[model samples]
Target: MKEVVFQASLDGNCLFLNPAWETITGYSVAESQGRQLLDFVREDDRPCIQTYLEQVKTGKQSSDHPVIRLSHKMGSFRFVEIFVWQTLNKHQQVNGLSGTLIDITDRRQAEAALRESEERFRQIADNMEEMFWIRDLRERKFLYINSAYEAFSGLSPQPLFSDENAFLDFVFEPDRDTVLRVFQEVEQSLSYQFRARHRDGSWRWLRVRAFSIQEGGSPSRRIGISADITSILEREQILEVSLKKEQELNALKSQFIATASHEFKTPLTAISSSVELVRYYLNREPQTPFTAVLTKHLNAISDRTTGLDELIMDTLTLSKLDEGKIQVCFQEVDLVALVEQVIVANFTNREDSRQVAVSVLGDPVWVTIDVKLMSHVLTNLLSNAFKFSSTNPGLVIEFSEHAVRLVVTDQGIGIPEKDRAYLFGKFFRASNVHQIKGTGLGLAICKEYVELMQGYLGVDSTEGIGTMFTITFEK
Candidate 1:
């Protein structure tokens, strides 16, 4: 913002210095008036400044000056950018030089600091073993990715970024659906393990995470990382087979799960898509018996398909947790909004949206949890509340400075006394609720999940009154 105006003779002697020059260079107009312009310039820069003035003086250049540093009255040099042009007499001959020197010391220093900071970060990112990336979710393109990506994948990012789906082409076909599914669930940050094609003609396991980035309270982009987890997956594969020939049997169980999940997901995704199409067409048709019937069936298909997708994911999560293969990513999350979302998803099929009442008793709750896993835990509890309750279900969230507590209460047949002791055992179901269909893995998975998040789960119930599941975690 500083500008010092000056007029100089053909030989570069200062003939005039404006008042602004005194404030910038710490030299009064009287002291600067009769001095040579090059006398105040740094010795190293005087030549370039002189050369620029001479060029303009001979009409070889029009309106330009070389940037130079001037010695200040305080015995320091201040960087300034000069813009000079030759003044012309009425006869069109060069008369003198007129110019302005704008101080840019602070701006130059800032630019240098930024370059150093970027280099520091670049060094760290380049040497990382894991592949890190940031994507502009709005544009569906990568903003940045590290060198490790090309080193591991043996593929440059140029083409992959050019075509949005080009990266997916390298994913194993069976794992593609799950990968695409995760990207579409864009409301929250999530992570999962999947297999992808590697450069050495082998399949490698990758643990990838995606987080929705928000600006102004809305999603603006995504940031994610992918790490090679083949060794971990190999261990899981070995552990799944008989101990005698464990390593050799690596392919058996992993393939079983992958194949089973792929089969389950593929058909469900197709069914849901088809149902949506049918629903869209039916909406345009007049209200008739056949149309009503078709619409109802389509709706049923959509709901059932979604339930199946959840079931597949939950089962896989339980497997990972039991095998000690699950990786937790803890980050700050809005516990209240997460709980509210779970409730909304569960009650989507209900006649009244208020079937499950959620009461947040305290201030906005923020906690550190693996959002993907925590969401699964909350969804299980909330879904159970709605499924078992004959009347309206009640959810209470109590958050304090020291801790957070959530209580999900249902008004249906409670856990029998005998079953209460083994309620969390895998496949253990209460005898009274045998008619209700369930995997019996819900409570067991939830218990492991809550504990994994460094929290505790408890239950209170009477025979026919209800069951209230309580969760507690230190803030």
Candidate 2:
């Protein structure tokens, strides 16, 4: 037996102690022979042991009492349940006591640890943010849910167990069919995400995941967790709507700019031809009154009109680029000659133009490129140089059968460091260039044009010093 049985004489001296006692106390029969029973008890428990012995001897109690701690040879206490009866002599007078002692130390400690573990589990489950549940899959019933279910559903868990299918009523009707379909399948795992109708007439999005517990390959139970995701869903919906509206607005803006630019180009052409004709007449009569004044005013008109015309054309180019409407037809052309013509026309049109020093590395270098787009790229780069540079700027054209580079460098006020990253973005202007008369679309259009020919456009600049624009086309 696991019980430690022992007997003591009326004087409280040990008369017999069993093998289990030796095993428990680490004291053999020879060592415990002459010792009193109280000798093995701890000092603090000695009084209790003495009192219990007195009660048993006087017949005040028997068979059961509160546990007492006894000392083991290892110096640790062992709790034991002791039952004692009065031993009788042949004359029916009380002699010594015979008792049964059961060591309950392991049992007590195990009970304490179990209580602590259960409390910890309860605390975690009760305070959990996510809903934890266990359900009988075949019976279609919820067997367990934590306290969190009350806060989520605004109902106590007890009523949920009173009737099965209570969870179905919380699910929105539109989502019920899908939920039913998912649960109907005998799968090992199931997950559901949908809106569930809340108690207050509002809908809450819930994400539920479960794994089926099976017996003999048949569905038996399910363990599931659910979390509320309403706030996340609402935020995503708002962002989607905002993105759709922004895209629509950008499309309308592009169409408007394209139409307006197309309308402006016709009048701009007429004004340029009329200005040329007036200049032709004035030049023939060089001795005419206020001849210089007439020339200056006419030139001012021409410059302003040309600036307006360029802005409109830049806007139109940006619109077409946005719509991917630019056609790139590759044809062989003398790119060196084409660049020279662009520079000459730009300089000839300006009354007070900066001198552009040109260097050609090869004679009549032929390349395959889109003629119109390349013309725009050269014009934009040279115009930017002429407008910003204070002295002679250099334009170098280097070409070969496999590669071509057109580099334009100027001693102009360079782009600010902060603006360099956004320089090619549409309608983005440098912080320092606010006073310059520009629509901020020139570099953007130039970049798109170069990219259309499968070429690269890059800029090197230091603030307040100088800037260089490089366009390279490679086969």
Candidate 3:
């Protein structure tokens, strides 16, 4: 039998014991008989057994089912429950006490482990920075809430148990509707960001995420976490304001540059015209040494004026590009024809012994590009090529079914490795080309123009050896 029955006198001495007593305590029935039942109980729990026996002796008739520890013959202990009843003789007077013992060690041990696990969970949740909660939707009650909620809402968490909306009352007025809608519409999981009023009446941002507990295809509970995000939102707001201010400052700077470049053009034009008139008058009697010196100085002034004018024009173009004033008009142009036109117009009067060799891999390659911009790009590239190289330069035009490439290769004083990274920046001159007469805006302008036509401009160069500039476009 799983249960052991025993009979003891009112004084608590055992008179009879079932055979199962041997299985329970590892002691034979004969060894267990005539011994006090309290002898088998743990020292601390024996008093409980004694009280139970006293109660049964007073005609209590039933045991209180007190749990007590029983010692085994091997010196180990087991938890057991005691069930007692009073025996009555023919005269109806209580004569003996009878009871049953049932082993409950496994049940008691399981309950202990479960209590320990719950304690650990509570410790972790209470100390977390985020608010953790469990709500029973069917019962309309909050089953669990950690202490962090009190810190977040600035109110005691106790009131939240009775009022489901107590915590939501602190949500920012504008966000409360949305928060409620989300709660009503959420099926399985939820996530949202909202603002709430803290205890000090200051607003704070919070992000919440939740999962629903389902029962029979419907939600019956929700478990969720909410975290404070006020600092993160503040940082994001600051960054947005900074970016907007920077953009406005850049626009104002571009406008100022365009205005200044325009203001310089009138004076430069007057200087060029006066130099031409003076040259016209001096050429009529330019035979003496004095007159020849006058003529030379006039030519120098004219050249310098022209250089200044080119610089102003480049500056204006850059400002327009920054202000989004330039318009792009892509059209089908013959690449071979455009190359020939640029070479004839720009490099024809070069006094250097070096020449430009045009190599046409496929004749008359056609591409879609802005004619004016592409011409300017080609002119700038070829001008740089001829100006930098003392040896012959080469321009190759190659085209296939889907793409076209223009390569301008020159054996010039190539750019330094350190300067290549900033080559396309405005007014950036190479470290090795300080003596070269350049405003440093030509390549920058060329790059912007090329990109406007949906093309790419790239260069490969080695210092003092050679440089190659490639422009590629989709055909």
Candidate 4:
């Protein structure tokens, strides 16, 4: 019913028209009956219709099918396909034409819309900076590649359509095998970061990501984008070189510190010995005022020389630790005995030794620890406790089946809460302890030693109240 059936004389006069003619062109069947069929055709297309009809009338073509624009009653044209054949009389001679006119306006408009959409897509793809491509994986052919590919690869995109592996030929030799493997094994998605030779004879870094597109019952396609990452990689290389240079400078600075400390230690030792000799001789006749003054200055010099010597020793020890020259030798030692020995060795002769108390709580704790490192840790902690607190400094040893803990407590000016996080950092001294004499390296060295023995050294402190330092080791 959508098509109109009609008969017209061979001279092009309309003899009969169907009711569907009104539906197709907004013209009544009676009004269109007597008019020529050319009256309903667009003026520009009438010549084409005339030529086709002439050919059919002269027997040059048996039947004619021509798509032409027909004028509608509303001042617009509609596309229609005409299928006409000659009608024969009883004498077997052509007399009239019979045809069906089907409205094809919708199909024509759809085709036009498709062309416009394809144009828009092409424009967008061609303008991108990154290379975009589409390949029919099933057909082993490249379907689409943007102009950026030609710009980046310095080659025509034509050969790629026929030879899918042409780009692989330009891939840097070191990365070619990896790229090939990735392509062969790819399933849903793939990503590759590699270097490839560019048009300028330079290797360029590219980061490519590809995804498989499989539509219902259609051949699979691969759509991917490749971006130039050469600039980013260059920046990273520069940063790596800068970092290496900085590390080398730090190594040189450490060497200088080690050398200087060793050179100063010998003179400091001699100064301390000379001061002791002067003091020993002056003590025989030291009742006079001048001799008393001389003794006081000598004692001051001796004390300073001893402090200098201690500083040099601490510096040398830290340097060795930094260079990884100190090796830990672990031996099973009694915790209680070790604590007592460190206390007697470091604090027994001092006046504050009386304030130090030792307690063994559970059992005789034994731990595998480096003897020298453990001794050093115990000495530092106990010395700090006695120096900071006015009352008793408690050293408690607790033991269990799986763990051993040595807790050192002091009721002194505790570290500030804000400074506790950085307490163990090299040369980091709490603000509250600025007036106290310390080299600030003792805790840092202690922590390193404790960790080398596979133990943990932790601290808890409250400003103006107390501090507790704990060293824990697993059996």
TM-score of 4: 0.60
| lDDT of model number 4 | 0.87
lDDT of 3 by residue, 1-475 (tens): 6578989998888999888788888988887888888889999998777877777787663524898888999999888888889889999998998888998888999999999999999999999999999999887778899988888787887887998777778888999889888866546898999998887889999898999989998999999899999998889999999989988998888878777777888788888889988888888884999998898899889878888888988988988898788999987888788888888887776676556799888656568899999999988888888788787789999876777899999998998999899999998999988877889999999999999988999999999998999999876
What is the TM-score of each predicted model, taking all chains together?
0.49, 0.57, 0.64, 0.60
Candidate 2 to truth, TM: 0.57
lDDT of 1: 0.82
Location of the lowest summed lDDT over 10 successive residues in candidate 3: 55-64
Tens digits of per-residue lDDT, candidate 2, 1-475, equal 5587888998888888888888777788789976898888778878877888889899997555757777878888888877877799999998998887788999999999999998998798889998888878777777889987778887767866867556777888999889878756667887889777766779899998889888887889887788998998889999999989977987998978877877887888898999999999999995666988899999998988988987887777777787788889999988878877887777665566556788887655678889888888888788788778777778898876777899999898989998899999988988988878788898998898898888999999998888999999885
**Which candidate leads the pack in TM-score?**
3
The deviation in Å at residue 305 for candidate 2 is 4.3
Off by over 4 Å in 2: 1-121, 128-130, 136-143, 173-177, 184-189, 193-197, 201-205, 211-221, 228-244, 273-306, 313-428, 442-475
Clashing pairs in 1: none
* Model 2 steric clash total: 0
Of candidates 3 and 2, the better by lDDT:
3
Give per-residue lDDT, candidate 4, residue 245. Answer: 93
